[model samples]
Target: MSEPHPASVPLLEVAGLRVSAGSRMLVKDFALTLARGERVGLIGESGSGKSVTAAALTGLLPEELQICGTVRLDGVHYNLVGASDRQMSRIRGQRTGMVFQEPLSALNPLMRVGRQVAEALTQHGTLSGHAAAARSVELLASVQLPDPAEAARAYPHQLSGGQRQRVMLAMALANDPDLLICDEPTTALDVSVQHQMLQLISDGVARRGSGLLFITHDLAVAASICDRILVMRDGVLVEQGATADVFTRPQHDYTRGLLAASDLDATDSSGRLFTVSSAAGYVPAAARKRVPAAEPAVPDVPNSTVSESARPDDGAHSDIRDAEPLIRVSGLNRTYRRGRSSLFRAPSEVHALRDVSFEVAAGQRFGIVGESGSGKSTLLRILAGLDQPTSGSVQVAGNEVAGSRENELLELRRQLQIVFQDPMGSLNPRMRVRDLIAEPLLLPGEPVAARHHAGRVAEMLNAVGLPPDAAERFPHQFSGGQRQRIAIARALICEPRILVADEPVSALDVSVRAQVLNLLADLVDKYRLTLVFVSHDLGVVKHLCDTVAVMHQGRIVESGPTGQVYAAPEHEYTQRLVASSLSLQPGSSLPT
Candidate 1:
């Protein structure tokens, strides 16, 4: 038999692929070709068929949907429009491996991490149990998971988000398949971890000489790693070309809009602002430049910004005298104890936070900006009363948190609420929308009848841009964006004075993210609530926040108004962060 014609035949070929759900066509006439060892990226906003195309490629589409297309891999033709389940299963893991967006759910909770990987390897006939176990360790090491031997014994919940993602990567690479598909693998990760994950994928594909299909909505991320990019909009393939050409000269208006709305800096133009404590020998130049300068004064902006008389003079600081602070923390610290190897050895302590102090005034949208492992979440948890600080005090609505008795603490908790990053995990699967929204009101010492609460829930649903009947659906019945609206309604049910949103919309689609953000801004204004917004995305923070606080290694290095900090950063770390934010300015690549 003739050797497989590598040049004449594509590794994976998708032509005129189309999919629809009921009356709506989610993916329309999508086409692409990938040669062996080539990496291609697919980018689009929510409901643009990016994920649908990915699902079709791996034969994971739901039975309710209709598909029509030609999909071939390694010169073997397969009609995905009506392919059998057995045929698809034979091709899925053996020939094409996929790493899903959520690693936590993708990996089995009951199985050990190592066994999960080994199972894939053994099922593919790549190795026996013993050999596969050893290969699993190697795979884990290849992804740079620390102590692969020990981590193999750990479960999915035991590892951090980044680590679990690495385990997912290991499973995808276990069989050494010719094609690897990664769907927004870094969406939940921090910037540093995201960079590392991309680098790992790039290196692994090169070594195995495999074709890669990367799906994401983040333009900067796709631009950084992909050789070619395909832009999709509303179920249609708008454009496809080299990454540089597509980014430099986008042909479609939707493509241009996506690039513009991404808010990621194309280059590292600004100087460093604050030192990153986790990174060695990383001193920010901006910190050195402020040697002789005096401390700057805060700017004055009215609480409402509605009344001309209430507005301050040009140089006056913003006022919070009459209004109570929504969230307050003084000298807060959190320490985690690492287990000791021997009985005689004392457990090692990890200082997640140290001397963190700040206040978010009522109706003030405050920001906590930081890199990974900088204790941003730790501080948010303390303020939300999810976790107690190792030292220092927390006050919410003038009620002392640390010193309060159990009864008093419960009341204080009612006045404060948090919206976490992962909407899917945050919501309960068994509960319907109405019960989830009414949960906060059902807390101790609250007055909310089923009849009266149903109306309030519906009102909250509408406020978050959801339909009134959305209250009747279950959590999984809605899309990611709609589910987030349910989460928001749950947070607002108690009419809390303070809202701690920890990376709330970061996982959302760009278009959906904007809607959620606008809703948050409006809600904050109408309720006169204090907002502690924690996010790694600097662009979002700049738009949503009135005041900003930069955190590094559990400490606040800089704090001031958003405009002042963005325009002229005082700390080196802050400068780096601002610069790292992707920009669409002419003649610029991704910021270093």
Candidate 2:
């Protein structure tokens, strides 16, 4: 037996690897290699074999899936595919470490944060007892966590999303593994937090002299982290090259479509935006019927209840300087008292919103941008009537929102509807699609029959580009983007005067994100509904909103027209947000 030369063998390598589930191939002829201290990114849309490839490498795939070909990822030259359970167990924490997409699901619920990290180091025949505990605290501190001692004692749920992600990073590098696989780690984070986390990952990998396999749908993020890139589509490698060349001059149509769909900084002034058709394809789908460029901007949809009559005099695309305001918030304040329920602790009030004010005119697209715990959610909750303000004057459509009676509240609910960020969380798993969308119309005092509900539901399905037969399926059966469309359909069932969207497209993939955004823009134009959107991505805000307000801490730090505020940010926090967000422009360097 001859050992491979250390100078020639790469730290990570996959040759002709293929993964399949029954007769369906998930990944075919996948080949990748990473030298020491190299960062390689695998980019693709959902169901494009990125996660499956990662699973195959890490031995995380379920038993039903069949894996073939060669995979050489080792800390001590051990085989990965057919290793014994005990041998595989030893390889996981000691040889290669993995950071999963969702920290809450990955981290143990009943364990302390420090114990989780310590177990990785101790169970793998390394540090133990006080030594492990000390190293765990050191790892947390190295990740720039505040008050490392307190964080070590806190449970997984006690930490914020960014904090939990940092903990995962600390654990991944615990034993100083030779290779690391991070799967969509920052997919759910705000721009500020996402930039910081990416920096932390890069720093950690560099400190350990480890190779990284970064998998994500974000192209700009890939450019920032990975030196090399692989583009996958429909279980095959469409293109592979250096990050710069691939991004600036992609050869494959699939790669081009992904790039066009993910360009958030794109706008009308930046040239005609590259748009992917409704049908799924790298190139334009053969069945797609595009409208002439000269026609009105609004898309034509058959069997849609939304029409010219549904729209107000002011359209979404028109300049709304002369339009009347629909929502007004003046000096709003919301305070929450902590430790009030405990007899031994003195109650301390936390100001969630302080003197916040903004206005949304009829048919105006208004965006509220902020990071987590920046009071954006608090302001949105108050507007949705889910929370009461401590002191403020809030008015919607000439109706006072503060201290309304039950009947008045019901009326307000009908006039204003809200769509949440997580589509699956907002939908009912047990209910059929038709019944779920019809729930709003079935409210008391409405004279609607079963036949009418079915008709209205079918019409909305057609409008959202879903099939009529989809009504028979449950929410769990649909994809994440489809569930979001269903959520949007439910919000529009009653034809509400105002639509409040809270990060509606953040959870979707690049292509699905474009589709959903186009749908929202069309709905706003056709129905003339005022939109109040909350997001952390400034590029998204600039594209969809005419005006934007930057929220920091508990106050409105900056507010102006979208282009003005974005182009010349005055506040420090606002400027940082714009700088940290990924760019759509070519040759753009990622945040460090």
Candidate 3:
């Protein structure tokens, strides 16, 4: 079926948009037209030029890139092909507002959240300071931030990921822009929060009658909220049509490839590990038909003999009652106290986690999925021994976390490690790769010398797909993917039995994400380690975890085997999560 064409004049238009970094073309012949009050979604994988095109529209391309295109905002025609910084700045934040992927970095840390939103309003027009602040609070309230007045006084660090995004939205809408461009705004948010954020943007845009250009790598997200869709590849528009029609019947080969790649098929139940092949080119139908019919089709599992033999050790610990959990939490709770006010004023308490309980078995891969502000990270922090639960029991390797002495906690720390999502921020700029990997080995009782440490570092580096010589390089010298590998190496240096990875692959590119996930899977089997994998990506969780736990409002709403939970999600939130994941193939539902 043909898609409905825009009835009104386009608020933003681009023609023959081309961009290059050095000699390599990043975007080519990209074109899109967004009508006033319309919502258009751009979908693709990482490095597909979705972000580049969004940046170009606002003249926010990096200095190194050379662009050539005709960009029209409303009736104003400007050649974005080679526009100057000054020319671009005049249009940015005035006629258009941008919501970035990472709101923490996008917002100013030093300024009050309300003030930041007000600044956007005050900069573009004649609003006074008090009026701007009042409008900013109203904007915050519109995005559904609790206690909007008090929230306005908070800084970016004081807010949760969802709250930070809300603040970003408030700031972006402060001036009532003609066009709002959101670049992966919900990428970092959990499933339910992601839904709410998308809905919020759609609602606000409709209310203001402003045009929207939503850029995301997630197809399902686009499907849920977009009016029209544009599929981009290598900076070119591969397909453009109504959201339903394009996803249902993608015409372009590139678009079809993207759809196929996003499939979440389970690994074959016949005890085989499946390796992902990312070679350039498409799989022929004849070759696919030649495969044995008896072989089970599991989507993300690596096909390798080694993986086949490495079945989970469920039988070794058959007596579930007798088996000890690698990590256990009972009645765990966490609370944060707001700063003091006047003498008579009581400090406000934020209950981040309220009596959460769960157990992780040895050699088992467990998942914790939740929305923003659900205390998922808080629970993880307590599990990693980075933070103490307010009032409850946490037992790690058979030691009571609350009753353990400082030395006992330190000993427990060696058996537990965490890998955060932002690898670049976690790594030290001054430290060499060798030291970064070896730092965990320097515990008081360990006897390895510096020379032996270097050897161990080399081994670990190679295990995670880094060169042996990577040990000598600095953190800044590596790409985002490589730095994450270093972080993994550092976490595993002490051979911790329990590895807590908090959204480890959320920030990486799609191709790199697959590589890291595979590396982690191998390490988990080789070390017989228990993994606590926390993430918002259902596809990754399904591929790696044996068990899944869904968290909502700081409580575990659903817990079961990965297959069971995904196949029959009892909770509405879980169902939504499974639904929110983008499928490469059109009209393909999750296993349920």
Write the residue-wise lDDT of candidate 3 on 1-592 in tens digits: 0122355767777888888998999999887777888788898877789888887788778888888878877645566556677777666777788999999888989999999988888876738679989998998999999999999999999999989998898888877777899999988787667867887888878877788888987766676677788987777787999776676566777665554344334222333222224322333222233457776322233431212122332554345324578788888878899987778899989899887888887777888887666788988877766778789999988767875557778878888999999988899899899988898888678755555688789888888889998988899998888999999999998888889999998887554665677678888878878889998777777777777889877778899877678889999988888876654432232220
Superposition TM-score, candidate 1 onto the true structure: 0.73
Number of the top candidate by TM-score?
2
Measured with C-alpha atoms, the lDDT of residue 405 in candidate 3 is 58
Which ten contiguous residues of candidate 3 have the minimum total lDDT? 304-313
Write the number of the candidate with greater TM-score, choosing between 1 and 3. Answer: 3
Name the lDDT value of residue 162 in candidate 1.
Answer: 93
lDDT of 1 at 65: 91
Query: What do the candidate models score in CA lDDT, each in turn?
Result: 0.76, 0.80, 0.76
By lDDT, the best candidate is 2
lDDT of 2 at 246: 78
**Lowest-scoring 10 consecutive residues by lDDT in candidate 2?**
303-312
What does candidate 2's lDDT look like per residue over 1-592, in tens digits? 0233374568877888899999999999999888878888899988999999998888888999998877777445665766667877877877788998999999999999999999999998689999999999999999999998899999999999999999999998898888889999999898988988988998888887788999999887887888788998878999999776777667877777787677643322212223444212222211111335575332343211111111122344466746777898999999998877578778989999999887888878888999888898888888877888899988888777777756677777887898899988888899899988988888678656545689899988988889999999999999988999999999998999999999998888888887787788788777879999898877677777777899999999999778778779999999999889865332344432
TM-score list, all predictions = 0.73, 0.89, 0.77
